[model samples]
Structures are given as structure tokens and as C-alpha cells.
Target: MKLNSDYWEDRYQNNEIGWNVGKITTPIKNYIDQLKDKTIRILIPGAGNGYEFEYLIHKGFKNVFVVDFASTPLENIKIRIPNLDKNQLILSDFFELEGKYDLIIEQTFFCAIKPNLRENYVHKMNSLLNPKGKLAGLLFQFPLSENGPPFGGSIQEYKKLFEADFKIKYLEIAYNSIKSRKDNELFFIFLLK
Candidate 1:
């Protein structure tokens, strides 16, 4: 199946986003809470509904940006965070975006793409960050197969994929995952190599 803008947009149009957690997950919130730099340029690609964006803004992180080609989710974020800057709410394909970010967030986005594009995803993420920038967040740890937008992946696969361009700062099962995802997700931090 084509997992393009039309496919993802359709998911939002049909209210079929099971991957959306409705709120920022605990692991990400805890990470953000510990960050001292409020001015860091942060990017959240494929941000469905942007709960993280709202959470970051509420916490006073002023340089947050989110991109998702789906109109429904971007509109939802605008309604939720009424004061969000239009320039930062990017309604475009993640792979086509061009920018340098201090940090990039990964939620369910990586797995949402087709498995063959995993390598390209890594390259795109590497190019999007400035030197020493980081790509951090959660990844599913289940077996991968040909059956989903919520495709599964293992820790080993992720390491092998990202290590070439990023220094693996942390990669392990997340302790604070919401109960629904406990033991099934890995929280990771990959800094530019």
C-alpha cells in the first residue's frame, strides 16, 4: 500500500489514527522537563495532532516546530494551540523538509514509513540536524513484517540503521512508556556523529 500523503491524510480524515496517544507520552515529557534550553530549535516530523508540540509550548519552549502532510492533524494542533506560529506548523512531507534543528523528535513516525525507506529516513534525519544535534524519542520494539503503518522494529535493527550517522547515546526499553506501550517500546537518543 502507498504510505504517502494521501494515505496518511486519509487516516486523519477517517479518524483512524490509533498511533496517536492523545497526549504527550510520559517518557517524552520527562525528557523535555529536564531540558534547560528553552530556545533550542526543535522539530517534530510526522507529528500527528501534535500533543508534544502543545506540551512543549505550554512548558515555554518557544522554538518548537512540527510537520505533517496531513491537514487534519495540523489543523487540530492549530485549534489546540491557538497561538501557534503558522510558519512553524509545516504542512509538508517530512522527507521534503529542509532545515537545521537542535533536536528532532521521533514518535511513531519512523515505523509509519515503509521498511525499505528506513535507510533513507536515517539519512534524511542526519541531514536535517546541525552538528551535534540530536534525534531523540521512542521506537517500537516488536517484530517487523509487511503488515502496517505501525510497523514494528527491534533494538538491533535500529542500532545498525542509525549508528552510521549518529552516536548512539541511549537505546533501551523505556521505563516510563504508557501502560499500553510498556515493554514494547525503546526510548533512544542519537546525536550527530
Candidate 2:
């Protein structure tokens, strides 16, 4: 099954995005709250409803951007944030995207892609970040299986996958995950190595 624009659009059209928690999850919100630089360029790839994007704008962040191939959520975002710059909403494949951001906010994008693309995703993220940039957000901590866009992975797997490209700042159970996610989520911060 191709997890392309059509697949994702169908998901949104059918309300099948279980990973979308309506708003930015608590772990990421707490991380964003502590960030001292509001000017940092931030990218949230595969940002379904862009709750993080919405929250950042509310918090006075000006250089935030979100990319998604599906048009449904992007249109939804436009309606929700009428004042948002249209250019900041990129409609393109994340791998083909080009830019340098000081921080890339990962929510569910990592798992949404095919498992075979995991290494490529890491490399693309590496190329997208500016020097010493960071990638921070939540990752599901569960068994890997063939069943989902919300496919899961363990901390050990994540450490091996990201360690060569990033210095693991933290990779552990998320203490503040929403009640639904609870102990099933991992909050992480990784700085480009």
C-alpha cells in the first residue's frame, strides 16, 4: 500500500488519523514552552492539523513552518489560521523539501512513512537542519509491526537509528503524554552531531 498523498487525503477525509490528538501533545508543548528563542526557524513535517504550528504562532513564533503532501489538513489549517502566511504552509514531499531550520519538530511524521524509509528520513532530517540544530518531539514506544502509519518502535531501535546523526539528549518514556498515550510514548531531544 502506497502511503502517498491519496492515502493520507483519504485518512483525513475519513477521519482516520488516530495519531492526531486534536492539539499539540503535552510532551511537545512542554518542550516548546521552555524554548528561549522565538526566532528560531522550526519545521513540523507531516503536521496533520498543525496544532504545534498553531500553538507556536500563538506563542509569538514567527519563523515556524509545516509541510504535508495532503491538501485536506493544509486547507483546514488555512481556515483555522487565516492570518498564517501561505508560504509557510508547504505542500510537498518532505524528502524533496529544501530548507535549513534551527529546529525540526517531529510529532508523528517519522512513523507515518514506510519503515523502509526510516534511514532516509533520518538523512533528510539531517540535511534539513542548520548547524547544531535540534530535532525534538514524541515517538511511540511500542512493538514494531506491519499494521500502521502510527507504527511503533522501541527506544533501543531509535537510539541506533539516530545516534550516528544526532547526539541523544534524551530518549525515554514521556512523563507528560496525553492520557491516551500514557506510557506508550517516548519524549526525545536530539541535537545534530
Off by over 4 Å in 2: none
Candidate with top lDDT is 2
Write down the lDDT of every candidate, Cα atoms only: 0.92, 0.93
lDDT of 2 by residue, 1-193 (tens): 8999999999999998877778888899999999999999999999989999999999999999999989999999999999888999999999999999999999999889888899999999999999999999989888998898778999999999999999999998999889999999999999998
Q: Candidate 2's error at 10, in angstroms?
A: 0.8
What is the C-alpha lDDT profile of model 1 across 107-150, one tens digit per residue? Answer: 88998989999999999999999999999999999999989978
- Model 2 — TM-score against the truth? 0.98
Clashing pairs in 1: none
Q: What is the lDDT of residue 74 in candidate 2?
A: 94
Q: Residue pairs in steric clash, candidate 2?
A: none
RMSD of each: 0.7, 0.7
TM-score of 1: 0.98
